[model samples]
Target: MRAMDEATVRHVARLARLELTEADVRRFAADMSKITDFVSALREVDVQGAEMTLHPIANRNQWREDEAQPGFKREDAVSNAADSEQNFFKVPPVIE
Candidate 1:
């Protein structure tokens, strides 16, 4: 990979729908170049036997068994609604 340049930075900004000034573009190019260099350095590391983990530390998930439960009655559920029809809440139209 090559270091990020002014043209590449401008292209990326255009693709992202950003409007950047010349000074901003120059600053971003330098920042992006540093990031690219860091990533290139990381590619040189040897990790053939390293285990992939989602997090830095090991954690156990707390799980619970699925169980059926009773639900509220239609009347009770719609009791607080300002308007309800056929056990469903009624709201003002959002679209024409």
Candidate 2:
């Protein structure tokens, strides 16, 4: 596998909105290069008869019954709102 270059690392950082120093770019370039090299090595492993599994360990979801519950009053819920009307929190218009 080709080594990860500084240019690629910088481009990825830009896409992620990261502010990286020159040292960070160089470090990430080396780190990503190692990762790709390891993955390349893994590609050579024999798995012709290996069974695909979603997870290493077995897991199951616990089911629960749905139940109705009482909640806070409307007045109390909106008590901290800067502006409210008709039991609803009001905010500035987002459009226009």
Candidate 3:
């Protein structure tokens, strides 16, 4: 793998809106190089005829009895809010 250059680092810093110092840029270059090397090594792994696995443990959707359950009161739900009216919590207007 090719070594990470200063131009590439500067370009990335600009895109990420990062204000990196000269020392930070040098350190980041080294770290990014190591990460690239690790990814390159991963590319060498053979996974021919391998089935994709989402989780290691066997899992199934557990069903429960659908019954009416008592829940928290409306007053309790808005108790912690800064502003509330008519049993509803008030929030800042999202649209002008």
Lowest summed-lDDT stretch of 10 residues in model 1? 61-70
Higher-scoring candidate on TM-score, 1 or 3: 3
Better of 2 and 3 by lDDT: 2
lDDT of each: 0.92, 0.92, 0.91
Off by over 4 Å in 1: 47-96
TM-score winner among the candidates? 2
Sorted on TM-score, best first, the list reads 2, 3, 1
Encode model 1's per-residue lDDT on 14-88: one tens digit a residue.
Answer: 999999999999999999999888889878889899888789888889877788678999989999999999999
Residue 87 Cα positional deviation in candidate 1, in Å, after optimal superposition: 25
Clashes of 1: 0
User: How do the predictions measure up, each by TM-score?
Assistant: 0.45, 0.53, 0.47
